[model samples]
Target: MKRIFTGGTILTMAENKQVEAVYVEDNVIKAVGTLAECREAAGSGYQTVDLNGRCMMPGFVDTHTHPMMLGMCRIWADLDYPKVAGIDDLIRVLKEHGKTLPAGEAIRGYAFDQRNFKERRHPTAADLDQVSTDVYVQIMHASGHCNVVNTKLLRAIGVTDETPDPPGGALGRDKDGKPNGQLFDSANDLLSGLDGVQPQNHGPNIHMPDSPDHLMQRFEVGQDFFVRAGITTVNEVQLTKQELNTYLRARDQGKLKMRMEMSFLSNYLDDVIALGFNSTFGDNWLTIGSIKFYSDASLLSGTANVSTGYLDSDRHEGYNYHEPEEMIEILVKAHKNRLHTLTHATGDGAVDPIIDAIEKAQAEDPWPEAIHRVEHAGLVTEEQAIRMGKLGMIPSTQPEFLYLYGDGVVDAIGEEKGREFMPMARFKKYCSLYTISSDAPVTTPNPMEAISTAVTRRTNEGTVLCPEQAITVEDGLKAYTIYAARTLRRSHIAGSIEVGKLADFAILSESPLDLKEDEIQRMRDIKVMETWLDGEKIYEKK
Candidate 1:
């Protein structure tokens, strides 16, 4: 079927291009130019879709998020701000939730940030014990890098005072040297016990299982979060066996809607290579894009391997997941096998080793087109940016971090370093392209929030962390659309509203470019009027 989209500002997202109308046929863009030209291209027997003065652009491509986890979070107790204000509120909320669960079921809560608490401290086992000592209670930090379990769960997991810290992860201890129920990074694996989902030591363990039917429901719920927010594509950056199975089930059942590029955990590196799997292993809807590695823990958790210590002594300097040589060896193996890599590195300390490994990998076996990404690349130096530019690395970062946690970051890292957080402008200067994403379930999956944060550099409290690092609104949109598509190597097929590209589009209530600097915060208020994929309207505002 042929359709001509008219009466809207069509943002092609290709070198600041805009058109009065877009001509589509059989789910692909056939032409884009003046309304008359598009109508002429459409010929007869075509449909006219009136946009009514809205703005049309490429659907957002969220390059990093955990859809399964995001869905699972929906079922868990939401402890995000304004929901639970402090430890007392957290305990009260958990107790209320505990009453609703049946016996033998673990009570899982997520999105609790201690920074928002009046006490400004993690809820220890003692605090969680107030909820229920009879059942297993675990609350995950907003960063997903840490978890605080009740004493019962600690004992159930067999983590004792004598149990030494796991390599690449740590157990928070009290003044008496006893485990305090705080598990960081690899230590989160202990929560899985003997039969639960284990990611090995590749990354944090958050893939707790549920019934297959319930998991499928969760996947669908998560997909809605993206589609409603104008995101048509996403990169599941931490794909585990369970997540892969879920995706397969969703695909086979015809329930999967969003275009997904899966980045399997490094734990599967050997198996992937043995199977001769590369980035092009799957179809457009579900492709194997990269091998994901964790160089360090999360920056928001105050555990992102920074060179300098945090201001608070209690928040110790973070540690790397692997030694420099070991990381280099692993990266080299993947690089040699012609597999793309995405390593989570949120601090200079974490970013440096990844830089070294990529440098070594390229020197050993050069793949000029290889775009190994530094996930987060949150706190990078100018020199490191220069090196990353030369290596053709993609700094896949989340600008929403600034909008949500900028003040807390400043409080943790101090003023100077915090001001340089994310540094999208510097990245634009050196790197060929930088992509912005919502590490969703961490912030929000809404691209408008990210774009607002990127262009304004404003925190939740309206403080500009680094105004110098702010990019133009158009650039921010490009980062979430075209640049992000490039990161997934799908720009030709999905990114822009150009000839021969898929008809995936997001229609907004107003053009974001029309918002003045002072009205930048209003960007988040711009609603996604409709979202289309494959020339079909998938979502429309009620």
Candidate 2:
């Protein structure tokens, strides 16, 4: 049966087109034009849905996220800035959560940004010990580049004073040189590789796995979380083999609803090459994505390879996860195989080398369509932006970072250098190939909030970080809708509403363009009326 959806303002988001009605058949859009045209297109026996003057547009495509991590966050303790005040508050929350779990089970918490705490320091093992000495405890930083473990967790993971830090990573040390239970970068693998936990070589947030029977429950919760926020597609930025298999298992069981694109860790390059799998390898529900290579840790964690030293410490020039030559070698191999790649380059120092490596790979292999990208592209300078534009480099950025942590960024690097933090407007001037994302588990997946931040350049405290870098609301929306699909190489099938395209859309309570510019942040208050995927309404506001 066909369906004719009318009585709403439909923004096709394709070539800046608008229509009054849309006709959908099966799972694809049949036609989009005026009400009479749509009704004419849809013959008898067709269903009709009156939107009652609502606003409808393409569903959001969050170019970077981790569903498994989001699921883990749902099960774990919430340490987001709003929930905890200081170290004592953190301990109190953990203590209360620990009591509800089975004895000896590890208690995992996530999104704990020390910058938000009154102490202004990461909670040490001693701090976590205040929560529990009998049960193991692990708390991950909001950046997803670091983790903190209690004494019991350290012992459970077999890290001791004698344990040497992993290469290019660090285990926090006490004044007496004893391990202090904070893990950074690759050191996170110590916990991720533990029994019953998901494994990762590139990022943080390790937690116990869900039973096969229970996986769907947690997964549905995560899906609802995304759909409620108006996200229709997600790029699983970094996933280990086990996590990937879990998603595959869910798909086989017919549990997948949202479109999920995947990228493997760089360490898995060997497997990817052996399997002859490049990006975009599967059906719509699940598919291969870029190969993620972390050039450095996140900026807020103070481990990014920044050329300028941190303002707080003259000696703190951030470190890279791989040597220049090593990273280039990996890029060469992947590019030679014609695989798309997204390097996590957050600092000026990190950005240049990764770009150089990609340029070199393209020079040797000559695959212009691969669409190589830089994740974060956090501190790209003017010259680098021009070079990136010439090379057709796509920047997958998280604008919400500026809104949530802009103040800290200004503090890390002085205000002068800080202005370079995610210069979106500059990137648009130099290169038009950029997409915005939530990078959820680091921040909430709210497209409205992201768009608001991008357009206003204002932090949560209403401090304008760099108003010169602001973009228009329309540009911000395209970054999450059309351009985002372009980044994932799926623009043909998804991204917008057009003839023969997938009928995936979000119905809103009001039109964003109709609101005042000052009301951008309040766009978060706009209710999501319904979320439709493949012509089926998956979510509706009660």
Candidate 3:
């Protein structure tokens, strides 16, 4: 229904920087100016909702997220790295968990990165074995690219000492050719061939294939959580054309409230080419984003492909997992397919090479219209930042990551490496970077926490990582809104409170612009009163 929302402070994020009450007609914004102007624009049939002095801003457009993984959030034994400490602590926690379980059950846990630990060592099968032999287990590291398995799990999966390392992954065996119960980034990919493992013993430990219901539930729960935090949009990554269609179905059926933009997984670049899908193939509700690729794993896993061997481990040098030639081939393929490649490169050594591939694409024939997007563009050099901006690539980042990982980064990579950080001030002034999600179980999708961190540059413990990297709150707002719209290629349609734009925005209980430094850091003060998408009230505070 067409509506008028009045008596609210507004952050229009428009080119002219105007702020006012707005009138929504059907699915688009009919007007945004003074309250009188908005009321006048709305005819007799329109509904008026009072915003009660709350602030209205463009919906946050998260440029990178994994909506399906969110359904797996509380399903596993939550072995978050920050919760458990040493191996002993991990064992104790698992032993405690094992005691509560029946015999021969797997103690499954995800998001347990060893890099967050003081020792920076992987959790091994020996560790869980000490807890319970019958308690075969597999745990996902925080990087989401690796896992550790118990001997029983290995045996169940038919992984032997002599089992040749599968293509693109390692079995991680130790002396005398015994599987070490540890796996790296590509290791999970190899396990895809092994026996399926399910949460608990939910019937013979099968890996159930993801279905429409599985994905849709995640979208529902994930989107609900976002609306409560005043987020209006999320640009989810790791989607195929089929998955993309699922989200479209949600929008069409009126089940989806959050405005969505999705990045297609690079695995189906061929399908994208055959279908001839462009960047903005769908409506503002759900549009196609860049094609997501992973050059290497995150910094936490030693597989991040860094220039120097980590100072702590001499035997291990980060692998450039995406070989230069391989990267070139895939990148060239993406260019030919007319899809922008959004790569996840979180190490110093990986950045330049990926950029080189992009450079090659630009020089070659039939390059995609835009060379945009680098997901989790962490550990980048100043030169790379300059090069990325010049190339028009958006760096989708998670500030909450800085909140938790900042300390570990300094300890692992040294102060010099940690100092580079998100480079918010630098990006605001010099680059075309914007904020997106990296979500449900990776980190909270709250934009305000990101907004606070973006402005404060404060690490998790309130220690300032790089004071120079802080951007103003105003610009940070833009990063999550209009700049994000630019990332989704929906700038003209939904980013700002323009008259012709979609009536999609979030109503916040607290006006962040009016808050002080310490106030934003509190987080609880920033609350959502309501969320409207496509001129329809999708969520209302009960």
- Candidate with the greatest lDDT versus the true structure: 1
lDDT of 2 at 304: 81
TM-score of each: 0.98, 0.96, 0.89
**Which pairs in model 1 have colliding backbones?**
none
lDDT of 1 by residue, 3-54 (tens): 9998978888986488889999988999889989888898999999999999
Which predicted model would earn the best TM-score?
Answer: 1
Span of 10 residues, lowest total lDDT, candidate 1: 192-201
lDDT of 3 by residue, 440-491 (tens): 5577667887777777777876688888888877887888888887777777
Single out the weakest 10-residue window by summed lDDT for candidate 2: 198-207
lDDT of 2 at 474: 81
Order of models, best TM-score first: 1, 2, 3
Local error of candidate 2 at 28, Å?
0.6
How many clashes (backbone N, Cα, C below 3 Å) per candidate?
Answer: 0, 0, 1
Q: Which tens-of-lDDT digit does each residue in 299-386 have in candidate 2? A: 8877787787787533278788788888888888888887888888888898887788878988877986887889998888889999
